[model samples]
Target: MLPTYSPYEGGHDAPELRMPTGFSRNVPERRIHSHNDYWRDVPVYTALSHGVLSIEADVWLNPKDDVLYVSHSVAALTRARTFQRLYISQLVDVLERANVHDHETTFFNYVDYYSQENEREPRRLWTSFYEGNMTPIRLLVDLKTRGNETYHAVVRELAPLRERGWLTRWNGTHVVPGPVQVLLTGNGINADVRAQVAPARDRDVFLDAPLLKLDETWLGVDGVKYGWNSSLAPMASASFSSATSWTGRRTIDPATEEAPLAALISSTQSRGFETRLWSSPRWPTHVRDRVWRTLYDLGTDWLDADDIEAAAAF
Candidate 1:
């Protein structure tokens, strides 16, 4: 077995190991992004099956075509190295085979470099998700243009899906499972943002409130988003906690942070949400053992391996 992960031994003690998530993303230099069965990588997959609930992927739509592909950058979106076909299929297979895809949310993060104009162009990239019976995967569009039109494009792309009865909400938000998950990410608060790029009719999608910041009305939604790199040390303590406040560095080697991690687990458990480490390269055997120990004790939730795989894979 690979040294990074302690093969899923025995069972657990913490709160039912509820929300385990891992980004399907991977770094190219690591020989992970291009692997055909990328999800099967020893450390990555084992960690996933054992617990991961959510998967993050970066999606870039082709400038010349309506097709949207996964990859950090356009240069990485090559036909030989990556294909939209295999990317979605394999992941669906893995998730379905694992049986988590049914209820678990898949964050199909859109990372297109299109300008605000292009995003609002009313172009929608379509794909067949086997489990939902072509249910359009819930997309989290990160406006790459940084132009005022990021939200415009998000609304536009979701239009067709709305008409087809595929769209559940209009305001770029909807309930995933626990209840009415009203999201604020889709609604561009920027007045500078364009209006031509608005999504379909806008009746069902009641987009509101970013996930990272806790809104007073966040009662029904089961999950929340944390700002990408925001330091969560304040909420790291007990009392004031939410999924959005839990933190650890993506680049910090999971192996080394065992003790502090255990403390974090105990700290966060009192609040409700779990924790996960990301970024730093794989650690050695003994360190990984400690890492898993923390997982057992704390019931940590997600680990972001890298975006290279998630974006490029599908």
Candidate 2:
């Protein structure tokens, strides 16, 4: 039904073109979170190509070697698919190339000076695509093993990015935005993360707030009621099915369903945390589209999507 054209359609050689250092140039950044990003053919590159700013990786700590392996389960993990190799290293490479300039010596000196002064905004990943946009991309690490041990492993593995001043961090009083923001989630992550980062003057790791429990209070180290703030947990998430009763049958009820949903989203956003609802219905394409539209209309910050291309197009 469609005509096909060959590279040398007219019997002439195809022109050669060199790829630019800024490979993602002109790609508009999207709020879509690439769920199970490691499942992609090329992981981070696939999502980045679609302008998906947020990505997630499920990690397990191999106690033997003290390396973090990325996988949905232990059986799926391989030595080649490490957290450092797939994420941290790749990010460092991309950022290094993106921030590269003709005056390397001068640039490094200025960056170092700014780091000492604590007044510099690190050039973010998106700068490679849209130069000068310093907004950090989200990297959600779901710990599938023992929380504290695994969480620490993640921190250690982030050294490459940390050493380069490319990680968003809490500087005792405020949050310093960087090129990459790592949010720790899943088992055993909460207390350990809080204990470590809460006391440090400059800590890079953060916690993912529980969307449903955003209003609840927890006992702090001092035995006082501690509430979650953007500095500690910048984003909150929940299962879509747990949050709503809609099964993609009829339209979402404006009064009962929509109102509370909107209120919850408002509450989360009001506290400076972005809201993301995962585990939404994906089957029945029309239903998925409707729900996505509804969530977007209701002001959900990040769309958790398995299909990065479709979400980016949306």
Candidate 3:
């Protein structure tokens, strides 16, 4: 049965708070995705300073008051740590001052240069200004409340960024990239509900699909194969623990676990979605470092990490 927020229905008609303009810190971002980002001392800026490409914010909505709070757990929520305050507004503040260079133009020009030079070596593209690198940052919003309702509220609060063309969106034909791609995860919006929202004119937000579901039998499975597409999921991810039983005590044996991990990453990438592995071993001293090294050596697209400094260095 669909859960209803009845008595609290009319209580949440508060006006949306306006936010300040965003600014940019010029730096080259790493592939590290800082998990539980709200727990950081400074939230978004802390990850940004470390050159982390992605940051996560778990949002909880109070049905009675209609406020979205950012917290790792509901018990830790407070009005001061709101989604609008920490993430949405901060994003606006950074993106407002983002380097307005033409990435598409520069990219094509670089490709042409490589082709003209007849260079076989793959080229790396990094925009270097007087200050730092200017790459698009990703914001992963983990929904901790009711899916549909919270999804709608999240969309509503993103109007400022949406108006400025900072949020990623799916037009009817293609996925238009933006400065900040709002990826929805946790208890995501229902599939049927997503379908309804998928075709809207200004649909910029996207879903973070679960990579764990894609296995050898995915193609033959009913309902599993559906709703997985580039427009919906630019990236899909799974927990590292789910893929293997290695706890960092002993070295990971490639003979037993390599094929499956390879298959999962390769399969997901083949489907046009970037892959991420989270919930990896983080302690026991050398174990954490080893696990990070293994993941890096394996060429996973994004590293789900809590230690920003270590990930940045790695």
> How many pairs of residues collide in each model?
26, 0, 8
Local accuracy of candidate 2 as per-residue lDDT tens digits, 1-314:
23454455453333222222355677888999998786865677788888888988899999899999889987888998999888888888777766754443343454455455455553323354675566677899998897567877888889998988788899888888888999988863466556555455678988888899876666655555567778888999999998888776668999999988999999889989999999777878788888999999999999989888888888
What TM-scores do the predictions have? 0.36, 0.85, 0.76
Off by over 4 Å in 2: 1-21, 103-128, 219-225
Candidate 3, which segments miss by more than 4 Å at Cα?
1-26, 99-134, 192-195, 199-202, 215-226
Give the TM-score comparing model 3 with the true structure, all chains together. 0.76
Q: What is the lDDT of candidate 3?
A: 0.70
- Where is model 3 poorest over a 10-residue stretch in terms of lDDT? 14-23
- The candidate that wins on lDDT is 2
* Range of the 10 consecutive residues with the lowest summed lDDT in candidate 2: 11-20
Candidate 3 on 235-311: residue-level lDDT in tens?
88888888776676777778777666777778788888888988787786488888888777777899888888887
**Which of candidates 1 and 2 is the stronger one according to lDDT?**
2
> Which one wins on TM-score?
2
TM-score of 1: 0.36
